[model samples]
Target: MQKISTCLWFENQAEEAAKFYVSVFGDSRILDVSRFGEGGPGQAGQVITVEFEIEGRKFMALNGGAPANFTEAVSFVVDCSDQAEVDRYWSALTDGGAESMCGWLKDRYGVSWQIVPSVLGSLIGGPDPEGAQRAMQAMLGMQKLDIAALQTAYDG
Candidate 1:
């Protein structure tokens, strides 16, 4: 059992969101589900929470039954090794979502996610200040990160 897992508050999309997330990531599955009992706050047999794990991180989707709006203040970051990986995640996550500045995006469920490349850190924090700034500039203009473009900026 992992300690300190994340819990997502939802109006009523606990099961749906958990299943969607499980399908999106590899090495992930539904862990457990707790349902409402008779004469409860929710309908009997309705899912109260759906626990799941994605890439080793555990998450609980809760049917809090309120207007659960997610903000960009907290977001999950998906680090990709290359353009293909980045594109894959971007496509899946942004299918019904909106794109934001840089690599930030709001998924269909209103969850913010940052799909970034693994090399972004090095490119934007390299020893060469000019190169780093160039990389940062390149990243600022990109919705989906392009490793080649960032590398070119850093190399310049």
Candidate 2:
């Protein structure tokens, strides 16, 4: 068990969100689910919390009433090895969500995610300052990151 895990507050879709997240990431699964009991705050049998794992990271989703809305201030970063991985995560996460600049997105449930290519760091922070700046410029214009484009910019 991890010492600390992320707990997402949801209005009433903790279980549904957990299931959706499990489907999106590889090596992910639902670990446990707690439901409301009789005389509880919510209706009996309704899900109260869901514990899930994504790529070995633990998370909990709670069906708290009037959940605090998620903002870009806090986002989960998904490091991608290549463009395909970035594309896949972008599609899955942005299905019903909004897109922001530079590989940032909000999932259908309003959770913020950063589906970034692993090379982004070296490209934008490489020894070649000019090349890195160019790569940064290219990245600024893109929504879902394109590894090829970033590489080209870095090479140029």
Candidate 3:
């Protein structure tokens, strides 16, 4: 078992969200699920917790109900090898969610995600400070990162 797995709190969509996430990521699976007990806080037989993994990273979803909600404070970052990968994740994640600047998005379940190109770090933190600034400016103008545009900006 991996130590220090992330746990997400949901109103009651733990299982549903887990299934959706498993479908989105190319490498992911549902490890296990635990249902509520007769005297538990949640409805009996309802999903209490869902254990899953995405690209080998472990996560748990809890049906904590009301009060507990998702915010932009925390988000999952997906590193894409190219524009295709970025497009895929961006489309999947933003189907029923809102888009934010700089490749950030809120999924249907209100979870924030960052769909970033693998080269983003190098482009934005490269040795050439001017190129890095250009890349940063390009990224700031996009919702879903355009890898080609970023590359152009970096090369400028």
Tens-digit lDDT string for candidate 2 (46-119): 99999999999999999998868999999999999988899999999999998999999999999999999999
Clashes per model (N, Cα, C within 3 A): 0, 0, 0
Residue 122 lDDT in candidate 1: 97
> RMSD, each candidate, Å?
0.9, 0.8, 1.3
C-alpha lDDT of all candidate models, in order: 0.94, 0.94, 0.92
Model 3, range 22-121, lDDT digits (tens) per residue? 9999789999999979997767888889999999999999888775878989999888999999999999999899999999999999999999899999
In candidate 1, stretches whose alpha carbon ends up further than 4 angstroms from where it belongs are: none
Model 2 residue 143 CA deviation (Å) reads: 0.6
What overall lDDT, based on C-alpha atoms, would model 2 receive against the true structure? 0.94
Relative to the unseen true structure, what is the C-alpha lDDT of residue 11 in candidate 3, on a scale of 0 to 100?
A: 84
Model 1, C-alpha of 133: deviation from truth (Å): 0.6
Winner on TM-score (2 vs 3)? 2
Error of 3 at 70 (Å): 1.4
Task: Give the least accurate 10-residue stretch of model 2, judged by summed lDDT.
Answer: 62-71
